[model samples]
Target: MSNLTARLRASLVAALPPEQLLPDSQPEYVRSYVYVFGATTLASFGFLIISGIVLALFGPGWWHVSRIGHFFNSIHFWSVQAFFFFMVLHLWAQFFMAAWRGGRGITWLTGAVTFVVSLGAAFTGYLSQQNFDSQWIAVQGKDAMNAIGIGAYFNLLNFGQMYTYHVFLLPVAVAALTTVHLLQVRRRGVVPPIPPRGLGG
Candidate 1:
């Protein structure tokens, strides 16, 4: 047991050195408005999760009937909007900076996957709403799912299922993927800015 534990510790230390995992400082090039967007995106996502939890706890009906519930609902709604807005800005900035240049392809790929999955989460949230908008979205989503031959398994009209997906499964998946993406980013430090044309070899 002791030998096995030693091996595990060695492997972990080699894979993620303390300096890299918990850096005290970053490269000078890291100070830029573009880099700030990633932090903003994370902040928005944090609020989105908190607001979503409040909505889920009281059930969907409360949001439509009570003032407090409505307040939380509005927070959740606006947080979703802000999350995507910041995410898009972060994505564009990273793309322009070629963030995958320093062996960070997996980090970039995971972020992209998270965005795509978030769209599904948002779609399910719309369907789970007990309102006219939900009805319209369910009908439209059903047609789209049927066209893709996935309607049988993924019924947009099923409020319970959509709610389960939106409030539970999708959030878990997004959180897990986001964690991996962040770990990768830390493992392989941020990519540096491109050098000026005249300065290049």
Candidate 2:
């Protein structure tokens, strides 16, 4: 039986006693290199959140000027890079595998939505840096935002607004969506591999 199916049938197998459920905690490590893209993206996101909390506690001045703050800033920045890197891999892998097969359409949908929200979070993050770079971004973006008819509301030039979005609103949205995505995965389990051509047919 597949590992996931066996695990899901735990209650039925519980009657088998300890001798049968060997290595219950240990996962199939051999699958990690190919199958762990989603997990790796999550790990990167964890680092992003922790490092972001540190940077937030210190405020803009400290992060832009202080040495220790610079260290954490680097961590947060690199974590974003890693998050996107593994997220793309996970997304594409799921796409090609048709992970929406079976009743997993919502699972795939949640993941796709999370990616779009993460983009907004990352964009606001660039604006929250509170430096010349941020000023340049605001100047360049404000006109576009106005042209698009949201500048009055969003006000990309407003540091406090962008900072609040980067620090609070968008992050919460991403986290909430990610949580729902995870719950869906747990509910339906991962999609199984496709059968070979003409094999299952």
Predicted model with the maximum TM-score: 1
Candidate 1 residue lDDT tens string, 1-201: 369988999988987899998999999988778888888888988998999888878887999999999999899888889989999999999999989986889999999999999999888988877999999999977988999889999989889899999999998999999988888898888897787789976
- Per-candidate RMSD, Å: 1.6, 7.3
In angstroms, the error of model 2 at 48 is 0.8
- Say which candidate scores most in lDDT: 1
Task: Tell me each candidate's TM-score.
Answer: 0.94, 0.82
Model 1 lDDT-worst window of ten: 192-201
Clash count per candidate: 0, 0
lDDT of 2 by residue, 117-178 (tens): 99989989999987788889999999999997999899998889999999999999999999
List the pairs of residues colliding in candidate 2.
Answer: none
Model 2, TM vs. native: 0.82
